[model samples]
Target: MTAPPPEQRPDRPRRCFVIGPIGNSYAAHGSPERAAYEHHLEVFEEVISPACEKFGITALRADGIASPGDINEQICRHVIESDLVVADLSGGNPNVMYELGLRHLWGLPVIHIGEDGQLPFDIASVRTIKYQRTRTSLAGTRRRIESALAAGIQDGFELLTPARVLRAIQPGAGPAPERPPARPPGREGGGDLPGLLDDCASVEDGLDGVTGQLAAISGAIETVGTLAERSGAEALDLLQAGAPAIARLAAVSRLADALRAPAGELHALTRDFSARTAALDSGMRTALGLVEAAGPEERDEGNADFLDQLVSLDEEVRAALSRLAALSASAGRMHLLSRHLREPVRDLSGALRQLRSAVTCMGGWAAAARGLLPAAAG
Candidate 1:
């Protein structure tokens, strides 16, 4: 009943991209600089990779991606798209800094680590796991990294990056707080088998409803995006020209209004789903224990259906989240359009924030579920 190592497991592994100086590999063998480069590689293998694998995350460095494409594009994709990133700040490498900046701007979770005492003052405020090259230090460093990753994956990563601080100060920005925690429905312990089935059934039902809701919102956002694409100069010119411009502006406002209700609904549903999944964490851990006791065959057979449903829901949520991100960018363009449009745009932006928070919660839930379920983790 013991689970296999993550790489040997049946599920698709979560990815953690490692970003740090690739050190001059071409440096003359045994040079001091060459030693520094080799040490970075050692950190990846000794500290970072093991920590990530503890959570089924495959650790990949920039040079590790094997796909055929522009290396720059590949690195960018991994930086932006990987489930997690571990940034090594040793020596303050420029390329590493640039990639870290991108991940921060994108507002994804990143764990920073550096050589003890070598970190730059400007980034000192950021929490980073520090380590030395000695065998003893690397073991301690790995434990810290594992603990950080586990917490970030379970509770959701919400670091106050520079971009987030700026957004907080923007004219229409407001905090998007999470919904209050509620007891997870359905799944209790072994005492409540029926309740557990009911809990999962309710989640499955919600997921089904959300599929249609997301499709409808996608259509609305498409219309809103097209209207929002109008250049600021064109909008200004139209306003100067009179009635037609007023009508056009009114039309955009109406579209925004149409989007509001469905977006709000989707946000609420995701928040509720996120809450339920989070509440299930302890229950799922308990279930994992049962799986171990019951053995692989029973675990696989028992979880087959439920695991598939979760994987599907994860995909649906991810697609919608990606679309909402684009819609938010389009909505930002409306700041220049008109006064009437601003309020709706502001409301829409707030809705987007709530959605983003909910999605982040869902992400954490999905990661934990991967530990419980053997099926593709999505």
Candidate 2:
């Protein structure tokens, strides 16, 4: 099935707050600058504010509030309660920046705007809507801002929710942005079914890669064990047969130490990957809901297709998880092998001490034998 465009999806309308610098002086309204401020306020009240209302949004302006302290708390409360925030950064006002910072901290959906030529440096990364002081420019800005807000609203309020932001940064999960459909017109069935199949294929490939890595690590662990056994047995033989065991013991110790780093790294990677996979699993389920409730017509051509894609994606995710599990098991085995190797090293240490004692005893025996031989010969 073909998925619907994001704008057509069923979601809630937004509640927006207009935040910026407001006039401070009580008698300043008679001045030209205050008149300009009033004009700007009139544009919002007459033009921008009504657009929000027409779109079933509740628009609140930040102007009437008294002090920066009150504005700060109010902005925080509004950000938490409202669906979106429209911030005017025209004056490079410090208070505006502070309020914007609060909105960012809450992970609120913010539409930034500035008077043409008044853009700030710090907000360079974000795209901002620019308007002129004239009526025509303000009208155009209102439309653009409203359109952007509409798109955000359709994506669900969760799109700007703090949890969603946190979820996006989580490892193992694909990005929060919607995934493109699997196939284009190039393949069979107008490219829908083929896309689903492709998704499945991708999952299979990921699983295969994970499995291969697991196998490689497992093989390395086995090799370490075999090497340890061979070296340990040789060292034991040298000790029993009155040959020096230092060389054999040292070789075994060095090999064990060499294996430690890789084993540790694999273990840490396994844990991090597992955490990432869990986050992905949650996100997939959420996406599935989005696809399923996209209306009946969307389900017809895109339903089966979307389901197919989802299933394929799920399978791939599971396969990767399974591979991670296998790797984890292998890590456990490596840990056990490392412990086992340590035992042999400990035994070698004890054997070295015993060998030293024997060497000392032999010296005594040689001295007594030398004395006896000399006396007898004399």
The candidate scoring highest on lDDT is 1
Q: Over the stretch 195-289, how does candidate 2's per-residue lDDT look in tens digits?
A: 33232353335434433443443444444445545655765776678775465556546656754554444444434433433323322333333
| Best candidate (score: TM-score) | 1
Go through the candidates in order and give each one's C-alpha lDDT: 0.62, 0.51
State the TM-score for model 1.
0.42
Among residues 3 or more apart in sequence or in different chains, the pairs in candidate 1 whose N, CA or C atoms overlap within 3 Å are 186-195
Off by over 4 Å in 2: 1-11, 29-33, 64-72, 156-378
Q: What tens digits encode model 1's per-residue C-alpha lDDT throughout 1-378?
A: 121322442233388899997777889998987987799889998889998888888999987888899796688778766767899998776567767765664455689999998897758999889998799999999999988977876665664454354233332243312210111233324343442233245445655655555555556555555555553345566577774865767765665565555445545554554455554443343333233333333343335555555556567667766876776776667646556456556655765665566566556545545655654433
Please give the lDDT score at residue 222 for candidate 2. 48
Clashing pairs in 2: 1-301, 1-302, 1-303, 1-305, 2-301, 2-302
Could you tell me how far off, in angstroms, the CA of residue 286 lies in candidate 1 after the best superposition? 45
Worst 10 residues of 1 by lDDT: 175-184
